[model samples]
Target: MVEGAWLWLTLFAIGSTTILTRGSFVLGGEGARLPPALQRALRYAPAAALSALIMPDLLLDAGAFDPANPKLVAGIVVALAAVRSRNPWLPFFAGMGVLLVLRKGLGW
Candidate 1:
């Protein structure tokens, strides 16, 4: 675990880097455009980030994929809910509800 001055220094460095990187566009003033390559790459950032965050939970169970995993079923429910309803919170609630039902009620 991080401790003492090292932790403070690490936190300060992270905060400084985040502010500088994210705020660069605003600080560069209006009408400033990113390079074409970066603009193209930025378009896929959300999908890539989301997959990076969620793919592991959907695919992994005790270090291996398990067909019987409740998370997999809940993820499917969430995916279908996401496609069927455009409302942002619907998929989250649906996924959680399905998970609860499967894990608690059905004992999946």
Candidate 2:
């Protein structure tokens, strides 16, 4: 509603939401400990979010789904690396390397 720039407004909204979300856990006491079933679901949250973020890029082909794609292959490789190792940089480099090889070296 203000006459300020869009970027500042966006940043403010993000920062405010972050504070509120973080504060929920910080303020909660022993009552906040999640139940077993809920904790099981929470365990998969990261994978679910990652899939939501990555699936479109891997599955989309010129705005449509294409089952056979290099990006999909590389993404799977990266996911495997992440699942196997605690080190963060390895998966990143693995994904980046696969993309480079597919796009530059193999021309596919």
Candidate 3:
């Protein structure tokens, strides 16, 4: 019961932070304008965050990295496609396709 209490509190904290971080602008109304440089930098935050989340999975594992990890290779392929195509959602499918092909053909 005591251990579970901390887990519940942690979940609550995470949920609260997620809501607040995402909805802060909505809550603040239309009067705010961040400085241009800050806004430009902040625009990249999501991509930076996503890369941060992906890097460990791409680059590391329990023992070490496996360059043959299909996910990482697929991610690179998707990233390059996204760069070339400049379409937001297409890379997702490309990456998925890469992973599926690698998994099926190479058994990775």
Candidate 4:
């Protein structure tokens, strides 16, 4: 485990980096405008980030591709539900319901 001066130095470096990056936009003010292409691309960042975080869990089981994985099945179900339903909550709940039923109720 990290200890002593090295740990404190590491934490300070991390904290400083976070503050500088996050504060850059605010400090730059109205003149600091992103390019139009960049602005458009940023719109997909949230979805990309979400998929980056979730796709692995859904597609991989025990570090191998598993077509029969319950999470994979639930993810497909949720994607369909999101496309069909206008209500956001419906997909969220549907995904959770399918996951729970598969993982717990049906013992997948």
Candidate 5:
């Protein structure tokens, strides 16, 4: 429905806002230092973001919580493998292997 100069203007506004907000730190240089507490909190942002993206898929099935889901089991396996093994790839491969085995080999 939106096709004309208005759409171009809206898109340009959005793009400019995004660039300014995302590049604020770089543009401000050392004067824009974050507080110490905020800096420390940012350290967990990646893990929190990843959990936000993955937890729903792992815990839900057909719009309901599923404790017996194979993905949940695989996630548990991944957590355990990560804790026990030093290699990062081991947990990923182990989780995928468990998932494949459960979904394909055992038909869970």
Candidate 6:
């Protein structure tokens, strides 16, 4: 069992960290602006995050990459849909649809 003081200290630390981290944005009013370089760099954050989230799933299989994996093909379809549609959620649905069709209909 955790010691009472240690548990309380841990909870306090977590609460303080959460408040301080989130409070910065709240305290910075609507008109407050980040530096231009920071703003420009931040623009790639979503793309970077999406790649980080997706690349592993598309590329990896049983600890190795398989070029012929249906997931990779579905991912390609999703990428094309994203480029053509220029919409974020549409790519997700397109990927899901392709994955379903490949897995269920074509039995990939």
lDDT of 4 by residue, 10-76 (tens): 9999999888977878877868877999889989998999989998898889989877888988899
Q: For residues 17-66, could you state the per-residue lDDT of candidate 3 as single tens digits?
A: 98897887888887986789998999899999998888878777565977
Predicted candidate 5 versus true structure: per-residue lDDT over 1-108, tens digit per residue: 877999999899999988897888977796767899988998999899999999999999998988889999999999999899999799999999999999999999
Compared with the true structure, what per-residue lDDT tens digits does model 6 show for residues 18-57?
8886786787777876799998998899899989998988
Off by over 4 Å in 5: 1-23
CA deviation > 4 Å runs, candidate 3: 1-11, 19-48
Give the Å shift of residue 69 in candidate 1.
Answer: 1.1
User: What TM-score goes with each of the models?
Assistant: 0.72, 0.68, 0.58, 0.63, 0.67, 0.57
**lDDT: the better of candidates 4 and 6:** 4
Give the C-alpha miss distance for residue 105 in model 1, angstroms.
1.3
Candidate 5 similarity to native, TM-score: 0.67
- All predictions: root-mean-square deviation over Cα? 3.4, 4.3, 4.7, 4.8, 5.8, 6.7
What lDDT is reached at residue 40 by model 1?
Answer: 97
Model 6 segments beyond 4 Å from truth?
1-23, 28-35, 86-93
Clashes of each: 0, 0, 0, 0, 0, 0
Number of the top lDDT candidate:
5
Better of 2 and 6 by TM-score: 2
Error of 1 at 21 (Å): 3.6
